[model samples]
Target: MHTPEHILIINVTRIGDTLAATPAINALHEHWPQARISVVGSPHHIEILQNLPGVVRVGALTKNSALFRGWLGAKHFDLAVVYNYDQALVRYALRVARHVVAFRQKSPAINRRLYRCVDPDAYPTVHITEHALKLPVALGIRGANGRILYRCTPDEVDRAKDRLVGRNFDGKRPLIGLQIDSFPTKSYRDWPVESFLALCRRMLARWPQAGFLIYGGPAEMPRTQWLKQQLGDSACLFAGLLSLRETAAQMALTDLYIGVDTGPTHLMSSFDIPIIGLYHPRHPARSLGPKDHPLNFSLDHPHDAAPSSEPQSMSDITVDRVFCQVEKALATRGIS
Candidate 1:
């Protein structure tokens, strides 16, 4: 009912969830072309939104605890879109924005004040981004596109290439990026490292010209390093090396991606590249696989009753099976 000239989006979740809000954000820009967007989020996670279409400014909330109230008292946002159900943020949106759009949280009493909100479970089968669009859709807004808003510049892509060249990567072949580990502690979302290494070997045997870029965070350096060591030659590690923007740029250069159900894997989805995400039975592929990208291929496998190891389902998922999926994805040129 009310159009917000200046909009504030408050998302303080982790990398993946933060990135998950892109499609809806893009749709918001499309629906409201004249609106200026400002976002508040975690330090590193908000980096991806740097060049996002019409985003005027990005503010970090982690480094400054008082930033929330600053956003509220200093600038009055016509509308606030809160992605997660943090009660504090909900309260802030209510105080600052004339209108608020968010997903329904547990405390209906608080959410009842918002201009619009959607039940997250209503579209359980849909991509998370699609669910996000439901918020704007609830506002009688339409034509909101469903693409991630990560914008990589030519310079950044070239920088990624330079980084690769530094690592002895030849520009002649189609690069295949691999992310072997999930979050350091949350290994349940990860497939086995050996499986990735084995998959790399098969990939090398098939496409010798294919290069590998190993991606992970500082916490995942140990596991990522081992995989890089085993992968060897055409392989390079991007763990503690690149900034978030640089990661997107490098991922844009990748021909294909094979990784577990992790944040980086989802972050890589921003680029229009083919990604193979290995999923465990505990968490079904349909549940957490690629959101809107057709190029993403998710392989779901069975697991033991009790969780013996993380990614328990990996034991049942054979390297050949994963390789077959990888080959199939490459065969498509990720056109879908």
Candidate 2:
């Protein structure tokens, strides 16, 4: 295929999945530097891709929006790459773009229509970012650099700093960020709240001046609030108060992050901060942990020792094991 003048990437999914696709989108841009890249994502997450390096446009799309999206429009795109197997999204791409690339759909008729129908299981299980990269790799685009892209403006960074200062986090050394729980549906991935409280006690004992920024959505506020109460003045709770972008900006100022496998953890990976990501056996570190990160200290459940079809407990990841990594991260940064 000739170099396409315009490319469209559709990824209408949750934050983690949306962020996972950025590496593939980066590859597409590297190969075709001049092509105008546009992305359609979930309304809640489309903002995450707004200021990415090569993306010229970022918009929201739902299954409903896909139904009538291209019916009234001309095929102005030369190529379209879609992630996931939503038939509505695939059908919309078919209506609007000359050539489309996606995973092989369940319907044989849909499979027959794709420019490249990638067998999702053809490749061995790998990192989620690499898994998403398979879409662009089908088009001979390579060298993605294996880094998730996120940008915060100078103003945003300044405001984040001011906010941290307002919360009295300015003079705190080894300021750590805590993600108390994963989203509701993936509750299995959450480490117990008591574990987080215990971990904070250990850190405070070591550094004495260590401060924590507890982050979460409204649903997890009870856990985050309890953690704040346990830590007293040493912690500030941003659970139900901050916007996604606001939380991200605040995260960028932290010295370290400790969290479960979730969307905010994925966002933290974009920064150069030290991270300790706790993972469950079903979706272990090997599949979802940060890639090409210099300071990643991700721990997988013991059940991950031998891949299993059965469920395991997040409590299996002990506080001491996590503290060991915390010590190592602090030592690396000369935090003593």
Candidate 3:
């Protein structure tokens, strides 16, 4: 045990995974309240986690030279936690820390012989947040209260409202937010635009007084437009419009959110908003479901991926399957 006062976490996963890892970060902070906890991530996620409580620093891995790894290696971290156990990532941890802890994934023989490891069987069975917290749990470190907190100040909330109201979204109506894009390479996580349109159409028919807001970043604008074409003037498309902070504030007021397994779905988890989380088999319940959450509805493929099996895509998730989960989510939240 290093009695580590300064620590670093290396998580090369997406925005959702990085956010899910927060419980572990908070646990580490609780154990060493005055210690500095830093994270190395891509520039985009650095913005999300940088100013978070307990995070002392955010270092960029995407920018800087390949030799920057060598430079960071000299920082002499007291401890390092490697989330996704790639050999290159493990090697980085080994160089930076005197004590390196990693998940015990089946790896090459050389890596199997190297790192202090934890088996996955001992962790919480529900939600990625709880699963990540197991790293601290295995070491007897007390974890934070299993709540996902996004502290949006009243001013931020007011600003978000002002922005949305400017776009004619009155604060009174039930706001249902939709996320339609997954990463392009991971298109299997997406529900077809027409399917989403159908879901929205059903919601509108049921709740004519409600308003819908569609969310996505710049990369997703084209799909957002296609959804808009399907929807016509029936809904508001805020795609590529709000900053991450503003998006959080705006989503806080939402009556419900429907989307595939994406960043905003994880963000909405923090708000306690009822969510219809559409997932492919690619994102299993074991690692990425909502936690202690007020209302979470998920659609997952029954089949698990095998070495010989092809990965399942979002299109495999039928409109009817998602609509059933949506109705369940609304019922759970007592929205109707």
Best by lDDT: 2
> Of 2 and 3, which scores higher on TM-score?
2
Candidate order by decreasing lDDT: 2, 1, 3
Model 3 residue runs over 4 Å out of place are: 63-66, 69-76, 86-96, 104-115, 119-131, 142-150, 301-334
RMSD of each: 3.4, 1.5, 4.2
Clashes of 3: 2
Tens digit per residue, CA lDDT, model 3, 1-336? 757888888887778877888778878888878778888876676566656677778877642322347544364778888787566777667777777777886775535644467766543346678767767776678646665555677898898888777877774356788888878888877878888887788777777766778899989998898887777656788888887777888888777888877888887887777887776665764456666677777666656444126766566667777767767766756766
Each model's TM-score?
0.88, 0.97, 0.80
Which clashing pairs does model 1 show? none
| lDDT tens readout by residue for model 2, 103-127 | 9899999989999999785322788
lDDT value, candidate 3, whole model: 0.73
TM-score ranking from best to worst?
Answer: 2, 1, 3
lDDT of 1: 0.77
Question: Model 1 compared with the native: what TM-score?
Answer: 0.88
Q: All models: lDDT?
A: 0.77, 0.89, 0.73
Residue 286 error for model 1, in Å?
2.1
What is the number of residue pairs that collide in model 1?
0
- In candidate 2, stretches whose alpha carbon ends up further than 4 angstroms from where it belongs are 122-124, 307-310
Q: After superposition, how far is residue 66 of candidate 3 from its true place, in Å?
A: 6.6
| Residues 101-177 of candidate 1: C-alpha lDDT, one tens digit per residue | 88887897987888886777543366666667777788776766665557888899888878877878856366888
